[model samples]
Target: MTGTIYSLIPPLIMIILVLLTRKVTLSLGVGIIIGALFIHEFNVMDSIQQIWSAFYGIFVAEGGPNMGTFYLLFFLIFLGMLTAFMSASGGTRAFGEWAITKIQTKKGAQLLPFFLGIIIFIDDYFNSLAIGQVARPLTDRHKISRAKLAYLIDSTSAPVAVLSPISSWGAFIIGTIGAIIAEHNLSNFQPLESFVRMIPMNIYAIIAIFLVFLVVIFKLNLGAMRKHEQRAEETGELVDPNRNDIPGELKEEFVQTNSGRIYHLTIPIVVLIISTIAAMVITGRNNVEENATLLTIFENTNVNLSLFIGGLIAVYHSAIFYLIQMQPKTSTFLVLREGIKSMLPAIYILILAWVIGTIIENLGTGDYLALVVERSQLSPSYLPVIVFIVCGIMAFATGTSWGTFGIMLPIVGQIAVNSDVNMLLASLAAVLAGSVFGDHCSPISDTSILSSTGAGSNHIDHVLTQIPYAVIAAIITIIGYVVLGITGMVWITLILSLVLLFATALILNKLTQS
Candidate 1:
């Protein structure tokens, strides 16, 4: 079953189940078990062992704990606590009160996260959760839907991070591109230059960013998102009332200070941003060789550790503020407990997602998809779009863009080298673009889940509402890739793609309104 069409069954079943039942945890659990069974040829003992090993691997690998996963999970927990403390301290209410005077419009509330998402492009994980904490109050005050807020965060985080040279995503991609160049013996290819060049060719990311602003500025809510928006506008219900397990939602009642100020919220976030960046730089510096440049430092930075440090500091800071402001009877222990409790649902979903992702990888789902792409002897002109679609499918199924990049980049490199050297960058850009598009649509994707957690939206609601917008951008990206493949003109293709995207968005907005 490994590295064959049989490997596709588990993910396909999982996806179908999620869409039909909207039960993420159950669906993911079933997928994990089924994948394990398939990998072990239905041998009960071996399957059980495989499942255990995969589950164990999330926290333990080799001889030590998996710090990356641990750090991220802790970050989420701390972020939740931070949010709870901020709210309990009246920071959120104060921020909302302040925003009402400053923003004064629903459009401005929607735009806050959009712009913040772009401005904070160091890492998608940080951007997704942090933006939610900062902007949720404003969006809620203005009656903006949580689904829309999730879309804004999801749309901006990856697109901006993927494009920025200093970001974690960019550093990884550049390093990967360098290895591919060395392996293929493409001496003329400069990794940094190639990455910069591919930025414009990443039609999906660029167009996704544009689509977010267009949707916000033009009020282009479509499909399920329209329903979410309508509900928020009419009833002031930011989230779907039916969903009881929304993560990052502080349901526990706590006392708020009459003297709540915007600075209470802003200070902790600022501390987080500054401290995280400082940790990244410090960690990067420690790991780098003596003549390391800023880019190399970022490439070697401990992003998870940095995030953990930042979240820890922010939580501590918020707690101090909360303690000073809260009523005498409000126990600190309960606030912390409630904050942890609020994040448990997200944590479970994440762990399940990791386990299922591991099972699918063990089943060689990505390998099967990569094999299909490798076997296709398509024209060079079709390679960009073909790779785009394949990479998208792989990421969507696996629910991990970085995983898809690891599996597909090498294959894309080899395929582009053998087929047409001219299309290498275009094909490479397609991998990044398509992976993000697929991640945007995948219900199991970490960014999507985090985006939902961040915006306090129902996870399934975020996925359902965001898919239509992602698909539209992807369709436009396909056309853009086709033009890039045929013309080999980055500037022309990018310009035309943006034009088409704006025109499509405008037409759709007008039509949807009618």
Candidate 2:
């Protein structure tokens, strides 16, 4: 069952339908039904029952284990509420006005999100949602397309999170590495040290982050993204024309009072950032020694609960600010309602994504993919490249980088330790890099979905426009891994890869213009 090719059918069907119909929800539904049928041996009634059971289990029956899903839903709702409060109180408008005075160019508008994404490297989910919410108003004012904004938010998120030493992603990777070390009985293994060593070797993340700057600095937009930028610039329509029911667009004009100050927006956001970090430190205190390091604190922190507390604090702060400004309590309630309402579509998409990811996991998608890689007969020198490609495909199909890491890391670790293939570190780096790269490109990925939700961008447009850029980075990353595998020269390979990426971007920009 592990290596069965049949396991690929569901994701393939979903991807095809998404590309053809441009309907993510419908595509996921169909994929789920099809997966159910496969799991039940194609018995229609049994498949229907299984699908229903899965829905119930994910949404209701499995409560404690599924707290993460609930946390995300609450986070999104409160985020929407925060956005609405900011907008209705004129905080968003005031901030946009202030930003326009300082930044007065499209590049600045795009670069702001890039820098914010890098700064909020604690978690990709937090990074995507917060950056998108903050930058949407500025990007729209400057006529930068939502798709481009989503690309920036998404590109910065997992890349920065994966690279940061004291972040949720770093902790997760370290844990997985530690498990692999224990399982394989590998001697002298230092998880944190190994992860730090792998940072320079994470070619995809390095290139992805660099590409954001290159695209922003040079205004490089190709394919669907170019058309989107053109439409936004020429017509002042920052939203996708095909889908005009953008979440926050309708509420953009409804300011409760003209007395909104920039502090109204800045204060809550600052509180959110501070509260989240503090909560993380406090929660992890019991788990660590008195002289705990920052990394140790992050490793022991409960990210979901900390994020929930942060969101709650931000919401309360926003509400109090409105009251202090003499805004009616009724008006504040209405704004919160509107904010919650706007997130309904995103919430529905997220639920489906979770269900599908669950289905993929139950179907043993990652194990199947790993089995295929295990069976492949390749040279030892090519192991890193192969592992990278396999892990990327698994993450893209399953729409979860963390899940991919959990399933593939142990397998890859064992393979690397084999007598013939001594590539433990290289393979580990490849798995890490590939997981992030694939999640970056996956339409159904939670981070990707959150990016679109946060940017207030059309989900499919974000996926379509961002894929080409992700593919470009993946190509260069593959070359870098190949060079590393063969020459064992990490620094040299990285330099060459960086040069190649810049050249590729320059050439592609010229071709797009021509």
Candidate 3:
């Protein structure tokens, strides 16, 4: 079979395996086995050689296979632990206690998770774990389901990252997009500014974020979510409010604790947000965090370090000083250890994901795809939509957004220069939309796994549940891109797509209910 055939086989097999078993690691491992088989001429000796060669290619790319997720996994794990620490230390409970105090109505309660998600865009990893940990109690207080909160947090994670320039996510995204300009040799191409402007035009991201807000504000109905809103309206407890009486630091503090104390929950989170911005400035990332030339304290700091620092500070200030009970105990240290330990499985998966990406690169999969794209000489007008779908497919297959970008950026540059493509915007749109799309729905995606695990939903449950919503949004985005190219009305495409998405989500919600 051809390289293209081989390239796609892995992801398809992986997807089928996931749909069957709902196990991400198992699916990915199976995907790897298929990939090795295809490349190795279906011989055992050849398969081993192909896998080894594939692994070798990862190191040559200046981004080793593990390079993509090493830092991210580290940040996510510790970030989880920090959230656990805060929860265990009474910090999260303290915040929840306070948030529930102001809520005389169910409406305010639903809106709180939305608010928390919006604020946490400072860092997606921070946003994911932090919001999940902090808001769980508040949502629980308001009769919110874990699924609802997970949806809010997951929805917020990417949209905020999509919009915010100063985030851990921006670096990879901005980097890939900028490469298009360099590859196309576009004269006077302003990489950073171009990327910023394209965000509004990136329809899937803009719409998904908007849909979440609508869900909260207008109460646009969604699956199993209506039950939650009704319950909260009646009683300020979860749908199944009876505590299982599980003993430990996690108790019903939201109803018991005062509202003034609830605002304390917002403090470390607020500081983390402020500090994140401050860190960008402090570190010299400038306001446009990804491609900035600014220099300072964080100039040399990797994103994971920044996450750790921000998390430490958020826990110390928000939980330690403000939410303290009795006295600071040694258990806080234990929680950190436990949190780090919790991340070990994810860490291993990250390494394997990278390794597979490396193997794929060894087969020259990305380069081959780039070559195919370049030689096809696709029209500039369709580039944005094409890029979005193509990159989405690649990411869906590989389960690594960075790997998808790594392969696509240079190739996109080649196309932009060779053709009329707005290399910067088109490339930017492709990488951002593709990465987010992949992470949003891919079974093997690390973020997807964590979101499900953290929210207590089965991994496949999350994937199966979310795919319809994600696909609908993607369809709207395609229309948005086409309209953008024809009319040159960027904002029109942006706002209209958001509207369409909300309507579609509403429809999906109604469908899911039926």
Best by lDDT: 1
> In terms of lDDT, which candidate is stronger, 1 or 2?
1
Clashing pairs in 1: none
Q: Residues 72-122, candidate 2, lDDT per residue (tens digit)?
A: 688788888888877777788899999999999889999999999988999
- Candidate 3 accuracy as TM-score: 0.76
The candidate with the higher TM-score, 1 or 2, is 1
lDDT of 1 by residue, 319-422 (tens): 88987764563677878888888898899999999988899898998989999999988999989999999999999999999999998998999999998899
Q: How many Å off is the CA of 351 in candidate 1?
A: 0.3
Ranking of candidates on lDDT, top first = 1, 2, 3
Ranked candidates, highest TM-score first? 1, 2, 3
State model 1's lDDT: 0.91
Listed in order, each prediction's TM-score against the native is 0.98, 0.96, 0.76
For residue 467, what is the lDDT in candidate 3? 68
lDDT of candidate 3 over 305-347, digit per residue (tens): 4655565666567446423555435455555665566555555
Alpha-carbon RMSD to native, per candidate? 1.1, 2.0, 5.8
Candidate topping TM-score = 1
* The 10-residue segment with the lowest total lDDT in model 1: 323-332
Ten residues in sequence with the least summed lDDT for candidate 2: 245-254
Model 1: per-residue Cα lDDT at residue 253: 70
Compute the lDDT of residue 190 as modeled in candidate 3: 63
